[model samples]
Target: MPCLPHELIAWKILVRLPTKSLLQLRCVCKAWRDIISGADPSFSQAHLDHLHQQVKKPYSLLIAPRIKSESDMEDPRDTRRPWADMKVTSPGLYLWEESQKDIATLLFDISSFPAEGAATRHGLTHCDGLVFLPAEDTVRVLNPATRQIRVLPWSLNSVAPRRCPQGEGHQAFGFGRDHRSNAYKVARFFHRETRGMGGLGMEVFTIGKDQCWRETAVQPPYPFVAGLTATFFKGSLIWTIDYYSPMYDYSHLDDAANMPCFVRFNLEDESFSVMTGPPWYKGPTILTPTLPR
Candidate 1:
């Protein structure tokens, strides 16, 4: 059989396949693997672009469930009980595809990624086929398609959750690719309190490149409420402003004060900007209008 040109194989035929299939095809030979696994930046971007264009659902929904061990004696979430101290045993990541709307396919198990103590919260973030799993101190970058896991360096700024549930400090995370540098980056907002001193700051870490978390010159305009995942869109990470309180205090506020506002951090320039929230009618509605006078 006449051998196909590299362009025809890589660009035309290979780019058409989904990421999972492409990863598996890597074992076919070293040459094909290089093309599929991002040896060529253009090919990598082209494949991602192809996936976005062809699949209505460009990204997979990664579900990281906090499964409590059977031996857990108390519920950490119980307000009445003392800090349960029950460890969060996440059962690894599950992938939900558009084709399988009703079922979520398990990709990797907990044993695949090991960690000490509680490793994850309830949320997961995805961008360009990569899943970002943020833990207490370390952030893991997982390619569900390839089942490749890259654990990043522990951040000194990350404040470990306290024995009491409320002691969990304020922190939010986002992950995305910087088009200019062609590198994946993780951004975070944190307010660490110790010795009666609290400080708000932002940090960025470029995967496979940065040895440590670099504090960004741009700080978050508003404090981001913890437990809320930042959305990565168009080369930026955006988070809703926690106007009411920085310590996850959601109570004692009227409806008008509860409306959400956003702050955006650009990956390329490492700049922060405010984004307006959706238009909401703030005027009170008259229960019954006088019949047109």
Candidate 2:
């Protein structure tokens, strides 16, 4: 294998390459391929740990315009969409540094995204540098820096049990890394009509490998509020629901609303568990996970 310039030989420099370029580099030679692939679990972990010890700083923000179907631009298919300002459309993906500096650089067009007939109204979820853009009927996983994309299988909600009259449920999405296998995963949840309004449907997609969605077990105790965002933290996806809402029929059980709980789905194990929420939490409230100092 030919030697790379001393500067380019470093793993740190190579890891910074955009997704496409890094992949292209793999074709350069056997040596380059090994270096790129080696950075996966072992090298990547050490590098990130070193960075955490340094002074903390604000990172870039993932910005996309509000979910507006008519306003989504699928035509001009440019990465940066330099002429985007001309059309009264929406804001494309860009990075914002401290003091609101615009980096109109990365081209992350999910249209023709993970599927053919482009999905619309992207709901973005970010974790460990992978951004999940959930569209109408499809879900796209992307590394904006790497320029890599993964599209998930279509939702089987249409054919799943209790298709008609969806039984007053909400859709939630969680994206995070499964430390056990060192792979990224996406977890989606929603409610299906069943006895006692306790049945919840869950489907999981492992990025880059799984081609289809696999259903899992869920017996929810609260009524899910539709359109509420799901958060990913510590390998678990958490969703907030209304425990006392009229939407939940409580005749068969005790006061369902009296105990508000968090429906947590662990990505690696692919299991659902319920835990007692904060004592202050009485009704539905927005919840997100964060690292402690």
Candidate 3:
């Protein structure tokens, strides 16, 4: 009998294999590679949706070693350990061992977060095979299995804004993907000084393109907020403002709230909106992407 069609065979094999196997099999052939790479949105979305439904309960969690600051290291008797654990229900963190430099592709296993004799110097945030490190202004995108790190070009000065003489404030950085463009983007939210003073300015940098940053038209009304936390979902950037109102004055009382609200910036239309959260949920945290079950 003749061999089964490549797509058919691939689909059959993919259904039985784990997420890691499917990721690795993407490198097996050109056709298989394209399919798994999400070049075809419909199929990719379907596969992602199926996987989401299959693992609705809980699979694994990503754990990273906590960073030790100079203030926390004053005690001479303190000892350092190699591993850290964090409970995660979604597939977010990716691991790439430094030792396996050349062939380091992204690992999907939480257990693989701290493999035998692996260094835990850098924490990882995964999007595709890309690993983002926020402790510094730089990002490292690598495939641990292939040990290939595509260091995209960026300006050091652009990322670190100049300090205002009056000590006004600084901006916050967030990284996420734009599904419509199928590109990864880094967004910066700057604080404005006053009304008509350009309340909030957003600069977005897309991956695989020349070093170019585009600014958005929407601006936040309040200028008192100190920090911004952003995440990408459904082709837009969602930002969370974390602010502490000074007791000195109540000028910003109109904008003050106990919980942060979701501020969305649509990449396709370049628009902004204030989004309300679930009725039962409370507190502020980075919004992570979740595949629907």
Candidate 4:
């Protein structure tokens, strides 16, 4: 009976620790490993919830392209190789903490990239605690706090053509959670045709599942701004559809294609719905809607 009580106490104490610590503890023993295995359905949600709570104290910002100024000081996100002769620029992250403003706020050490051994680019889409990085031919998802990284398989969007008819073969990626399946998914929208960009195709890749890119039956009503990234909210992926209205600009639309709005693709049904956009904005517009994490 004494042994049973002590074992129960240890388990209880273990669950309450930070998930990173729990992951390291898994290697301690078989019994401890099973306590936090991914096979256990409840483990993931509890771990994510705990992480969500912990990161809130010091809010994390998901930045893209470049967030820091260039200076003579040593920078970890230098795009050039160690022995390179020319200059290259890579995406870098800056963290904001209320109490720690005096110290430098970069996430990784000054000499390391986000993924230690990989090519670095300047595009990232963020959802939940993970930031999804897109390179020329690959996609990587990183959990900033836990130091976890996942590289996705090649998909339709990965191999984009050199030139596109509509707007230079633009592709946008979305990452989000599906509550119904309790799975995280990466969504890609791009033109599949080599010569034409008439309409975009949608493909989904579920994390931890050995599934190929599953094509969706639906496509966006208006052409997507090839450069814009998708925003995640309420189990849906949102993006600003870039199209000029006939009433305002005669080049992009007629009576047939009047206007398009901010659009959302529901992760569950693999379908899209047009949402209200800005009443007035001259340049390319993106709807900024806030959803609780």
TM-score of each: 0.77, 0.67, 0.56, 0.71
Number of the top candidate by lDDT? 1
List the lowest-lDDT window of 10 residues for candidate 3: 112-121
lDDT of 4 by residue, 1-293 (tens): 34555346444676568756776887877776776655565665766666667645664454343323234227666666442222334445556566766554655322234322122232466766667876545677877665667888787455444554442335667788888887888887776554334346778888888467887777666555554567788899887775531112324543332345577889887888886545564444444444454
Off by over 4 Å in 2: 1-30, 37-53, 67-91, 99-122, 159-170, 193-198, 217-223, 244-247, 250-258, 284-293
lDDT tens digits, residues 1-293, model 1?
A: 99998778998999888777887899988899889877787898888778668635534467777755655545556565333355556677787877787888887775535533442452567787678887666678888677678888878877667632236545778888898987899988887573211356889999878999999976666676565667777888777666545334434434642243677789999998875454562422211111110
Model 2 Cα lDDT, one tens digit per residue, 30-121 = 76776665434555554445555657667667676433234445654645644323222234466676665655443565444222222223
Off-target runs (Cα >4 Å) in candidate 1 are 55-60, 73-84, 111-122, 162-166, 194-198, 244-260, 281-293
> How does each model score on lDDT?
0.69, 0.58, 0.49, 0.61
Q: Candidate 3, residues 1-293: lDDT per residue as tens digits?
A: 99778778656656555566777888778987777665665555456556657644333332343433433346647555432322212222343455544443435332323222112122344554355543223444544433455554453333232342123234555566666665677665554443234444666677666475567566543222333335556676666543332212333435333344566777666677776445654544344323221
Residue 239 of candidate 2: its Cα lDDT? 67
Best by TM-score: 1
- Clash counts per candidate, in order, are 0, 3, 14, 0
TM-score comparison, 1 vs 3, better candidate:
1
lDDT of candidate 4 at residue 242, scale 0 to 100 = 58
How high a TM-score does candidate 3 get? 0.56
lDDT of 3 at 184: 73
